[model samples]
Target: MTRVVIVGGGPGGYEAALVAAQLGAEVCVVDRDGLGGSAVLTDCVPSKTLVATAEVINQVRESGELGVRIGRSAPDSGDVSDVSTDIAKVNARVKALAHNQSEDVGRALQREGVRVVRGSGRMAGPDRVAVTLADGGTEELAADVVLLATGARPRILPDAEPDGERILTWDQVYELDELPERLVVVGSGVTGAEFAGAYNALGSDVVLVSSRDRVLPTEDADAATVIEDVFTRRGMTVLSRSRAERVERRGDGVVVTLTDGRVVEGTHCLLAVGSIPNTADLGLETAGVATDERGFIEVDKVSRTTARGVYAAGDCTGVLMLASVAAMQGRIAMAHALGDAVSPLDLEEVAATVFTAPEIATVGWSQHDLDSGRVQAVGIKLPLTRNPRAKMQGIHDGFIKLMCRPGTGIVVGGVVVAPHASELIHPVSVAVSCRLTVDQLAHAFTVYPSLSGSIAEAARRLHVRGQQAPRKDS
Candidate 1:
């Protein structure tokens, strides 16, 4: 059997192990952390679960606007202001759900006959992995193929280290016993915007510190603007063009100093600056593997590092830095290394979602690509207010955007900005991946009074020279 050794039991590692084992490879996975890695145990799963709880509260807060009384005695007796979540209980549940998910991944790997080594794995030599066990023991394994999926950790500045209490990292916030009276979030990236919005919805006075002209600088400008507008309308204080220079605990609260010499005080501070890849001391040099100046492993389209028989995936590869992308990269790496028919990774098909109150989802080429003349296409944006379902849901802040080829009208990309936009973006992704024309997409039946209908509507508007595809019923 082909021997495969994978380091780090994140989605990339575990998922690849299953594929390798099923392919008749003897697979062994070495992971120091739990099976599901940070994506499950600390980062993605935990954060989204917290957001789910906040969504319940957010819905109740908006119930009054829909003529639904939330008070106990009188219609005004039980207001949404009375709806409060116990931080401790919510955090406990988050941890429990993350732990259960990790356990499930572990069980799945075991059932696939993949050997999981509980330790930190390092490259001992070419095609070899050395693992340091928890009990001070060491184990070594020879491999026909080696995969590295060691993920990343929250990045902190030298002057702003997380104390795990007053000053916290994204991963450390779950330990809070109570909600902060005021939360000052530094960094306006996806991670920052997500936490900042979540805390704001959870009843904390939130101040979002962004070093850019607006929040979510890398996202579509319109989507970012909508989120920022919502944040401000909901009473969040956004300090644009503000950079956090230092974070320090002051009494029971925390203080953040900006590079421009302004200070912001808050009951707690969250640092979502970014992440540092967990690639240190992995013995990359021993295996002839190489990393870039930023310490991210450089891999080709098939996840191959410089070393033969060696591959890398997940956050370590620095390709998109998304869990789903990491998993896809891992699968591709295994397929190529094992002589299975393999296709190189294509990022254009990947869909991303920002799980905020009014979520934003996107697939294929982005608005930035078209606006900057990177791609020749025509685009259309339809406001969600025009959608009957969105109107019924009282969701006024969102839109459906579609981009198609200028001549043929093939769907090139799309964006959905609304509640559950992630689900709505899937069809757009399919259209882009399959190279379907706008008419083909518009011909697809979408239930009336649904947000998905807007996707079809947006496509119909971009029909090539206004010609519609013949429908089966028509």
Candidate 2:
């Protein structure tokens, strides 16, 4: 039996352990954090759970618009009772849900006959792993193959470090007992935008500082514009082209200084600059496993490292800092290492979602590719405001976009921006992965008066547009 040792208990490490065990390999997982790693314990699960609570608050605020009387109004003053969120209760629930998920992942791995070691793991050699137990003891394990999935942590600026109080990282925000009256989110990326949107919906005055020209600079341009408009309409201050130079505690409040010498003050500041992979101090040099200059472990399509029998995946590999992608990379590495049929990682086919209000989800080629003439494709974008379900739900700030080959009409990619966009993107993901054409997507039946109807509509439009395009000569 092949002896496999996986370092880290994140999605990548844990998923690989299960697959390796199922393939009859003797598997052991060394994890510093509890099972499920940051995804379940702190980052993804916790943040999304908080977003869910915020969504409820937002919906309740829209009750009057829906013709539902929430609280009694005074005849003379015309004042109705206000609805407020209990930050303590919401944080408690987020922690509880995260804990439960971590426990579930642990139990599942145990049932699969994979040993879960509570400790930090380092590569002692190409085929050896040294585990530093939580109790400070050390144990060496022999391995035919070693998988590194150490994951990552929030990246902090040199001049502005998180104090876990006024200044905090995304992982540290769950500990707050009270919501900030004024929250400053310094980063316009997915994490920053998601938190800013969620908090603003939950009744906090938020200021988003973006070094770029707009929020979600990496996402679809139209989607970002909608979200930014929503943010501005909801009284959130968006400071574009502003880079935070430093953050410090200022008399019970937080003050952020921009590179241009402007200062913004808030009750609390959340640093969402990004993340740094946890790849250092893992004996990578001793094992001949190469990493990039930023300390991200370098891995090939099959997750193989520079070392012959070593593999790496997940955030540590910097392939894509997403849980689903990490899990898939882990499975791929295990299959290839254990002599099973495996496919190389195809990043274009992967689906991802931003868990913000009017969530943004995308798969495959983007508009940038088309505009750059990198790929010949026909595309169509249909607004959600045109969808009957969106109208009923009072949603008017999103769209569904489809891209396909001009002649063959093979669906190359898609983008969905609306409530529950994450769920709506799955069919598009399937179409892209299976190389389905726009005609096939358009032919599929979608529920009427549904947000998903827009997806099919976009596909149908793309199909028509594809037919109009001139074919290439053989």
Candidate 3:
């Protein structure tokens, strides 16, 4: 039986350990943090939970616009103080959920009989890992195969690095005992935009700093435009194409300096700049694992590194840098390493979601690809406001865009910008993965008066346009 030693208990590492152990390999996982990594313990789970509360605030705030106002009698001075945000309670719940998720992952691994070691792990060789245990002891584990799934950490700008207090990383936001009076989210990528929208809904005065033409520039152009418009309309101060040069804490607030000599001051600042792959200090060079210029491990579709018997996945490999992709890569590595059936990962077919207010979920065919003639595709967009369900839900913004091959009508990909778009993107992902045509997707039944019906309608329009007659007939 082959012995597999997996480093880092994030989605990539833990998932691979499970798959390897179940495949009859003796698997051991070395993790520095609690199991479940940042995705479960801090990043995805905690952020979403906070967004849930923010969503509640949004709904309550929007009720007045919906003509469903809950009148409050003239509040006495005492009642006003009692109605403040119970941030301590919210933090408690967030921490509890993070801990619970970590516990569940740990228990599942134990039940699966995978050896779980709490430690910092570094590769000793192509087939060996050296782990420094939590209690300050060290152990070397030999393996026939080694999986590296160490995840990434927030990319801190040299001038505005987080002090873990007034300036915070995404992971450290949950520790706040009170919400900020004003929040300046620097960097208008998915993370920055999402947090800005969430905190704005939670009643914080939010300012979004984007060094781009619009928010979510890497996402669908139309989707990004809608988000930017909505953010501006909702009182968010958006500074586009402006870079933050430094962040300093002032008395009871923080000040962010822009490269353009302008300054943005807020009660707190969140550096949502980006993340760097956690590839340093893991002794990868000794093991012959090749990393890219940016320190991201270079791995093949089957998650194999240049070093024989050594593999890397997840944020470490820089494969989409998503939890779902990370998990899939891990499983792929296990199957390939343990001599099981393995399928090479197709990045184009992977579904991705940004957890913003009206979440943006997409699969493939970026707008830049279409604009640059790299992809020969026809696109159709249908607004969510036109959908009956969206109307019923009182959602005024967002749209669904579908792209398909011009000749064959095969669906290339789609983008959904709406509430719960994350869940709604799965069907589109299935269509893209299976190479289903627009006609096939159009014929697929969707619930009436549903936001998803807009997707089908968009596909139908593509189908109709594809079948249009020649101008000579006109």
Candidate 4:
């Protein structure tokens, strides 16, 4: 039996440990932090839980605009500000849910018969790991393969480090006992936009700083436009094309200075400047493993590092920096290490979602295809307002877009932007994964008055793109 040792109990490590154990391998997972790793305990789960409360608040705030009577619109017609919010209860629930999820992950791993070591683990050699136990004792273990699933940490600017009080990282934001009076989110990426939208909905006067022309610049252009439009409509002060240079505490609050010499004051500031791979102090060089200049481990499709019998997965590999990608990399590593038929990782089929008000989800090739000329495909876009379900939900923005080969009619890629777009994008993912034809997708049944119908309609338009021939060669 091949012995497998996985470092870091994040989704990648835990999921791979379970797979290795099922394969009849002796699996041991060592992690300094609680089970479920950062994805569950601190970053993704906690943030999403907080966002859930924000979503509720957003819905309630919109009910008035929808003409839905909610206890008779506040007494003050001109001012109209009677809806009060309690942050203490919302924050407590968020932390409790995050803790419960972390515990559940630990319980499941234990039930799988995989040893869960709570400690910081470092490589002693290519195939040996030394665990510094929580109580300070050290334990050495040997394995046929070592999987590095250690996740990434938030990147802080040199001039503006998070003091965890006035300035905060994504993880530290969960510890807040009460909401800030004015929250300034510094970054326009997924994390930045998510927190900006969430806090704004949660009743904080929000100011979003974007170095780029629009928020979520890396996402689909149309989708980004929709989100930015909503942000402005909801009274969010969006400072586009402005990069934050420094953050300093002023009096009881903080002031963020942009490169252009303008300052924005806020009760609290959030640095959403992305993350760096966790590869320090791992003794990776001692084991003959190679890492990039940025310290991310270099691995192939099979998760094999430069050193034999050594593998790396998750954010450490810097493949996609997504938990889902990390989990897949770990499983592929175990399967290949244990003599099972393994397929190389194909990132093209990977689906990514941005959790905004109307979530944006995309899979396979993007609009970059049109610019690069890699694929000759026709694109079709349909607005959500055209859908009956969207009308019922009072959603006027967002759309479903599809791209297909003009000649072959095969669905190449697609993007969905709407409520639960993450879930609605699954069919598009299936089509892309299976390389389904446009006709096949158009034939698929989508319930009427549903968001998914828009996807099918987009496909149908592609199928009939050139159906109308030139009018008598005029």
Best by lDDT: 1
Q: Whose lDDT is higher: candidate 2's or candidate 3's?
A: 2
lDDT by residue for model 1 over 184-241, one digit each (tens)?
A: 9999999999999899888899999999999999998899999999999888999999
| CA error at residue 48 for candidate 3, angstroms | 1.2
Tens-place lDDT digits, model 2, residues 212-314: 9999999988889989998897789999999999999988999999999999999999999999999889999999999898999999999999999999989
lDDT of 4 by residue, 1-474 (tens): 788999999988998898898888999999888888899988888888888888777777676556554555653332223355678888788889988998898888888899989899999999899999998899998989999999999999887889888899988987787889999999999999999999998889999999999999998888899999999998899999999999998777999999999999999999999899889999898889999988999999999999999999999888898889989999999999988889899887899998888899999888777558987776878888889989888787789888877677777888898988889999999999999988899998989878898888877777755643111100
The sequence of per-residue lDDT tens digits that candidate 3 reaches over residues 321-399 is 8999999999999999889999999999999988877788999786567779999887877788788998887898888
What local lDDT does model 1 show for residue 460?
79
Total clashes in model 4, counting residue pairs 3 or more apart in sequence or in different chains: 0
lDDT of each: 0.90, 0.90, 0.86, 0.87
Worst 10 residues of 2 by lDDT: 72-81
Off by over 4 Å in 4: 71-82, 464-474
lDDT agreement of model 1 with the native = 0.90
Q: Candidates ranked by TM-score, best first? A: 1, 2, 4, 3
TM-score of each: 0.97, 0.96, 0.94, 0.96
Report RMSD (Å) for each prediction in the order shown.
3.3, 3.2, 3.8, 3.0
Lowest-scoring 10 consecutive residues by lDDT in candidate 3?
Answer: 73-82
